[model samples]
Target: MGRMIVSVQKSILVGEVSAPASKSYTHRAVFAAALGDGKCCLSNCLISEDTRSTMKACRLFGGSFEEISDKIYVSGFGKRLKVPDEIVDVGNSGTTLRFMTALSALCGSEITLLGDASLQKRPNTPLLETLQKMGARAYSKNNNGCAPLVVEGKIKPGIYSIDGSVSSQFISALLLVCPLLDGPTELSIHGELKSKPYVDITMDVAKAAGIEILEQIEQTDPTDPTDPTDQNKNSVSAKTGGKISYKIKGNQAYHLENYTVPGDFSSVSYVLAAAAMISGSDVDVKNLFPSAQGDLAIIHILKEMGADISWDKKEGTVHVSNSGKTLTGICVDAGEIPDLVPTLAVLGTFSEGRMEIKNAGHVRFKETDRLHAMATELSKMGAEIIETADGLIISGKGGAGLFGANLCGWDDHRIVMALFVAGLMTGGTTIDTAESVRISYPRFFEDMKKIGANAIEK
Candidate 1:
């Protein structure tokens, strides 16, 4: 049976909390280590369910690891990429599937990849098109472009262009496999790339791996958008579209013997948001990686909504102090920064004015239909929420007390966690699904308890 739980009524107390490991970094490290020639140490890795899924994929790709305490020592066959005897499972990890697909393409091996039920239902048509176009033999046995992908490796690559608007995971997939391209690989992207910070993180990791790319852009104005996929050879000409090209040469190597994963800003957001909403206390979270993660911008969103927040870069901590004053809702665009949408929406319900979040249609295709789920769940807690194609519009009663509600988690980690935050401010009993949160932050309830939220684990 699916599990559901409750949050005890109480305001969260403010205090200093250490940041969690970066899931983004942990995913990157897994891919990077799989390509490395020898043993390397991975420290500070977030030992979450998502990270475990990534590690499982790495194990199938000729990578071996030994975990001593909280650290991992990974040894990859490097050039000798292993072919699994059977299907390689990615679980619910999208990053694992995308990156592993591209890597398998380079190895010239026959690899069958599958994922969890939710992942199998995801629309990966764009990514499949790119991989197949780049000369990787890709076909689905079941739903096309979904999961259960079959790749005949040793791709004959030329110039490949991918749309940045689709999950940036596809872009990172190509970039990670660029080193194994047949020749100088050129990639062009068109349109306004959602989650530019994720691209930055990819490039950052690539640069550290001693791989350099020459970026070419058709023009700088993304508002005058162009689909990057329109530029590929045999690419469907979209009548009118421009492309930004990037080229990476072969025979490249990124040999890092040691890498430390930073604390996750996405996970840390919960504790910080709890501090402001429940206790109205000022707190600092330490060990966050400012250089990576697109979701770290939540601090700015919270600060704009009148939360007292600051960054201590030198000390590696984020100081968040509530004004002990009223919070007013503000209109914002959350498309590029979708993960932070839940936190902002939760905060919006406690504000004086209404909050409008536009340009986040992609939220519908996440682990669950987040926009509808969030609107429905928040409404159960007495929030006036409007569901739109683009995003959610929340009108708050300015931190007024809320009554109880039975909330659906929608099997989305962010959705469940956000409802938990909503419970803190509502001063009411909230029953939420627990299975959804296990998809990402598995220890969410324990983490919340450490910070003094009144929670009952079932």
Candidate 2:
């Protein structure tokens, strides 16, 4: 939908919702399957911008794919990727650009990683530096840390401590290619890891492909990660370069016969927050996985803010209702869940007090500088929001509901989703562009309508 406007009175929105697939898992599985020497099929893969980029990269690497409905069957020979004859274009998908850049390094050929206009502006310096440390001659073609990375192949594995300050995609990209390393790869992370759960997803998926990683924590930097997940890795000795080893027996192709993607909790935040903002509103969201998605922890955070939430893990769903209960504005540390921060801020806008979010400085480098973007857009909607060096301070009770405000999606999936959610709470229709949601959840707007939300293209 183009120029969608969501206008809803304080009313309960009903109906069913099937969440979008997990982008993290979908991307990891595709790469792992491509590295396999057998046939691997991924069912319920998200057919969004990011995953589509993964599909394209796999094809470029000479991996054959067959689509059976939403499922993708990839037959891969666990040999080196047949280097593409042309430049690989990864459109606005940071995951695709970053991971493929490293995978291309192992291809024994010269491969250039290129991306869309937005991705061209993001940094790929740290990834290049690490690939060099691994003895893979890599550099951005323009010598800037952005896209169109020219990688000269030949990654003879050695112990390299990746500076954990940048995006985890760099670390993940290397980890995916580790099993094929001539020796064990030990990574000494110099700083705190962001998106810890995503790394766990990467490591776990590697293990699933018969690749084992002996991850040992030598020292964890005192900085806060984007997500404080319980998924912890083992600490190994610096002996043997503290090498992490993955066993890929005969480079067997990992084939997932029937794969079911866990429901994306990040997409569910809009529905839940909308319910909380509406007086006497109650909404039931189905097919949510409590065990999956670090952002699902938002349910507990929302419950603490006085929303009635019921979750049945067996049924894989959650029901949220607030029967005229006031949303109490409370302080929260959103560093661990930066993606959810935008949704939380919007939810806070309807609360009665000031909400302080801390340890969230890294939100600046996401699909957009989220802290600035959130503050700017929320201010446009008449919410009193304070921009901060690290996080945000939002004083809610959005002035008798927001006025009709025009928002810039920033071509960021999270911002677009949050703005659309704000539109639902705005007493009048809020206008926004929907192009960015395709980066993560292309079906987000369509799913919003399934929940009985009043949203239509202008």
Candidate 3:
């Protein structure tokens, strides 16, 4: 595919647009539906490359999917999965690779999971160790922590403890498979859990599928400072001092039901940031559920940065407009909001002071190292940004003074979309690997055009 070159002449975005459905929720919902005892319908599902990978894995496990209009009707596997005739490839989706790994362990046959180049680089050792501790044989082909995992099926569920700081997907993977196990399962997280909201999404999806999960958060007494685990826990400083435990009752069955996915706050952040940066711009994003998504913290972050942004929780909408006003920078703790960092970094270029993004070290494990990508790419456009071990510190001077340049998307969907927003502020920006946006938001450029952004794909 050829590179997409985005050029913009002016900055005046105005209109109402509906946000796409949540990709995170869609992955969990599809997996849940596939494990259900009967047919289930998923409404407002995201038909993207990443979600398609998860659907493909479901089909390999004996689940069938039929698309009727915008909803997907799923005929479940009923917790009895079949060994795939070939290796299951998850493409670039980390969720698919991780969730399918645990699911494969429940079968009595061997299964191998593979992924694209980016996904292959992602660490899976923590999950493999957890599975091994639960009486399943799982190991990487290269003997490394990364992908190309082989699982000799037959899992015995019991107590399993894992480190939480690496990625919450490990815990969610275990949770997704525990309910289908032959025995009860207890998961104890030994360190600070980053992206805790994604785990909440997993629990919420499990509950919707008729599985009950009990969770407990216990903090350590600060006076007893003798534990080495407590010192390591400080890496995720945003979380409390103690481990969080999740208990799942096994031999449980999933019940099929009609499910509706909420609008994605992560995808909507780009549009909201575009409207906030431009002068005399007003954009309303519809179908957002603030309480359900952790990325809704973007609204609060924008408000703190002096952007004119407001949300009507009852109406399920957010209205953003700057009316020719400039934005100011503010410090943001991004522990639970890693997905918002890229868009926020773009918006920070248009603010008046330094913008600090902290406690988001986990972003490095995404499809690409977002902190390094944003810091390097944005700097090429004349914005001063510092990359720290945990986050970024950007010196904001507003978009009017910023200049555009040729950039690379690092083959990351969020990076491509965030750079497109930057293009609107300053024209003549060309982004290679721009098609990566299809992974999550296939209609991203179209949606931006609806709001009067001068964005063109060439």
Candidate 4:
């Protein structure tokens, strides 16, 4: 694929655009539907690069997916997954890589899974270790926890535990596959369980598919074998100081038929932030109904930063307007909302005071080290950003002393889109890796153009 460079000029945005389908929901729903017993129809599903990877993976599992009239009809493979004929390439989607890795243990024979460079860099040792404990032969090709992972079929169900600090995808991967095992399984989560809301999304989709998971908070030793790394062995999760236990009975089949994906708050964040920061801008983002998405906290965060933003939950619309008020930076707990860090960083740079984003160490393990990416790219645009071990500290200048400059997208969708928002605030900003937006929002620049943003591609 060819890369593009985008030049964004300062402009006032005003319009109403529908938010895209939730990428998180699409991933879970597609996998769940593919695991079901019969024909399932998914409406409003995201047809992006990441989601398409999930669809392709499902096909390799002996499921069939066809797009018709903007809906994807899935023929599930049930519990009888076929051994894939070729290596499963999951592209750059970490969700697909992790979830498919777990499900690969159910195949009749060995299945190998790999992804692009960014996805390979993401840590998966936590999930691989848990799968090994479940009596499955699972390991990284290089034995370093990253992908090019190989898994042999038939995991025995019993008890398993995983660390939750690095990526919630590990926890969600287990939640997706455990219910279909031959016997009952008990899963434990060690660490702070950062991005717990994503696990909630997994449970929500699983519940809708007639799968039940009983959950509770419990205490456990932090130094257990579940720890993903030896460095974190003795230290307890500072946020919870306890573990989450989940109980799932085996022999349950997924029974999904028709499911509609909710609008994505994560993708719409850039549009909303753009509307809030640019003066005289009035934009409405539609299709954003309430769901298990933690990124919905974007509304509260923007409001706390003094943006005139309101959400009509009933109508599924978020309206943002410039109220002639200067946005002021505030403290943010980013434990539950790592995807919003880049957008929040852009907002902070244009705000009035210091913005402290804490409890975001896991943000470093995303498609890119988002904390470092935002800090470096924004610094190029004349924003004073400090990179901490866990998060970012931006000394907000409120658009003062800010000048547009060439920026790097880090080949990350969130980083690119967030920098686009900052670019709108500081014209003459040019960003590479603009094509990365295809992963989540294929029409991001097109939609921004509809809202009067001067984001031109070259």
Instruction: For each candidate, give its TM-score against the true structure.
Output: 0.91, 0.89, 0.95, 0.95
How many steric overlaps does candidate 3 have? 2
Residue range 259-325, candidate 1, lDDT tens digits: 8877777777777776765546667788975676767767776777777778887788888776467
lDDT of 2: 0.72
- TM-score of model 1 (CA atoms): 0.91
lDDT of 3 at 291: 46
lDDT of 2 by residue, 1-458 (tens): 35544333333566667767778888887888888877877878777878888888888987777767768888874665687988999887888998888888887788888888778878888889988887779998778888889998678666667765567788888888766766666666665465555676787777777776766643324332332321222111111123232332222335444455667777778878877666666677777865435678778778877888878889877888767777777776654466788988888787878887766676787877889998998888888889898778888773365664777777688987887777776645454556677778877778777766776655
- Which pairs of residues have clashing backbones in candidate 4? none
Better structure of 1 and 4 per TM-score: 4
- lDDT digits (tens) for residues 1-458 of candidate 3: 56665555555899999999999999999999999869999999888999999999989989999876658889998867777899999999999999999998888678999999999889988899988888889999999888899999577878889988889899998898898887788999976688888998999999988898998767664443222112233333324555689999999998858999889999999999989988889899998876456788788878877789989988989999988788888777677778998998998877888888877799999999999999999999999899999989999876646787989999999998998888888877878788899999989988888889776677
How do all the candidates rank in terms of lDDT, highest first? 4, 3, 1, 2
Error of 4 at 147 (Å): 1.4
What tens digits encode model 4's per-residue C-alpha lDDT throughout 396-446?
878999999999999999999999999999899999999999999999999
lDDT of 3: 0.85
